[model samples]
Target: MNETIGNIKSRRSIRAFKQEQIKDEELQLILEAGLYAPSAHNQQSWHFTVIQNKEILDDLNESSKEAGKIFNDKYIQQLSNNEKFHTFYHAPTAVIISGKKDSLMPFADCAAATQNMLVAAQSIGIGSCWIGLVSLVFNGEKAKKYQDKLGIPEGYQPYHAVALGYKKVKSTKAFARKENTVNYIR
Candidate 1:
């Protein structure tokens, strides 16, 4: 198999990360990878906001938990109650992927960019995790204030966030694949 295939097969979701920040050059390459992801009409409607400041991240974490409390989801409520729960897992950097709310395929476009970032991160020995809980904070009516604080463009909305940093503990376990997933129609 080719190196790219090997990288794809070996990628895993990383939850633990070291305090050290990723190098600027490496971070740029990862961001570039995201920029290269296929988009509808090449609209490239995505806007990536990379946050390296620890204080801002801390605020986001706290506010996300606070927002979680308003949700009826048992999981969200439970997570909100846990003091240890952080949306970004304390990673050194976070990239928020946003797109125009009116776009026909904004979610899918942002998702592709996020996946590209993830694979690029893994290939470069960086750890990454896609954070979705922030949506809870953004989608709710009460979150408009927080959304403004995030500095997302007026017409755009964030679709995903990715935490990036060096791994504190490498994931060595292989994931088990479910069998018979495909239905061949030929």
Candidate 2:
């Protein structure tokens, strides 16, 4: 397989991460890969808020869980109620990806960037998890509070987050993929 395809196939959502922080150079490369992702009309509407502070990560985790408690999904509520569930899985670094509210296809653009970051991190021997639960913190009355704290721009809405750190246990295998999910034209 091609190197890029191999990297993509090897990427996994790692939850258990070591306490040691990833190097600044590695982080920069990951962020740059995100920046290089294709965007709709080249709008490049995504904004990244990198948070390395343990206190803030913990606060975001708790706040998101608090918001999830009242969510309509039972699974989310259960996760919220679980005392041991950390939104970011206690990763040493978290990057909040936000998109301009009025941009065309901001969500898609941000998602592409997020996927790019994840693949880049995996290629560099780092662990990464794409976190959607953290977006709950921006859905409640405390939205403005966190927006200010996270320094998200005035016109942007946070879409998701990526948790980054070294893996506590290396994952060596990919789970079996479902069959017949693809279609082809004759």
Candidate 3:
């Protein structure tokens, strides 16, 4: 297989991370890869906020806890008890992907950008996890502080976030794909 194809096939979601932080140069490359993702009508309405400060990361975790409180679900309540259950998964660096409020293709565009970042991270031996919990807090008052602190503008909303760091363990097993999910036109 081609190197690029191998990287794509080997990429996996890493929830466990090493304590070491990702280098600035490598992080920039990952962000640049995300920026190169295709956008609808070339709107390129996505904005990425790279967070490296531990203080801000802790605050974001607190906000996630607050947001989880609004839900009556038992599982959500349980999440609050897990001190390590941060929206950014305690990674040394987090990249928040935000999109314009009025864009119809915001979610799609942001998703592509995030995937690009993930693949780029994997290719460089860095681990990344796509975090949706932060986006869940986007509409609530609890997220306002994070939005402001992260420099997300008024007209933008966070759609997704990626936690980047060194992987603690590497899994060699490929995931088993479920059948009946795809339909062929031919």
**TM-score: model 1 vs. ground truth:** 0.93
Tens digits of per-residue lDDT for model 1, 1-186: 887887777778888889999999999999999999999988888989899999989988887788788787999889988999888999999999998878778898999999999999989999999997776767867567866777888888888999999999886766788999989889
List all candidate RMSDs to the true structure. Answer: 1.5, 0.9, 1.8
**Residue range 58-126, candidate 3, lDDT tens digits:** 888787777776766778778866776776767899999999878779889999999999999989999
How do the residues 1-186 of candidate 2 rate in per-residue lDDT, one tens digit apiece?
Answer: 888898899999999999999999999999999999999999999999999999999999999999999988999999999999999999999999999989999999999999999999989999999999888878789999999988999999999899999999787699999999999999
Which candidate number would show the highest lDDT if scored against the true structure? 2
Ranking of predictions according to TM-score: 2, 1, 3
Give the lDDT of residue 12 in candidate 1.
Answer: 82
Residue 32, model 3, lDDT = 98
Maximum-TM-score candidate: 2
Model 2 stretches with alpha carbons more than 4 Å out: none
How far off is residue 70 in model 2, in Å? 1.0
**Using Cα atoms with residue i matched to residue i, what is each candidate's TM-score against the true structure?**
0.93, 0.97, 0.91
lDDT of each: 0.87, 0.94, 0.86
Worst 10 residues of 1 by lDDT: 140-149
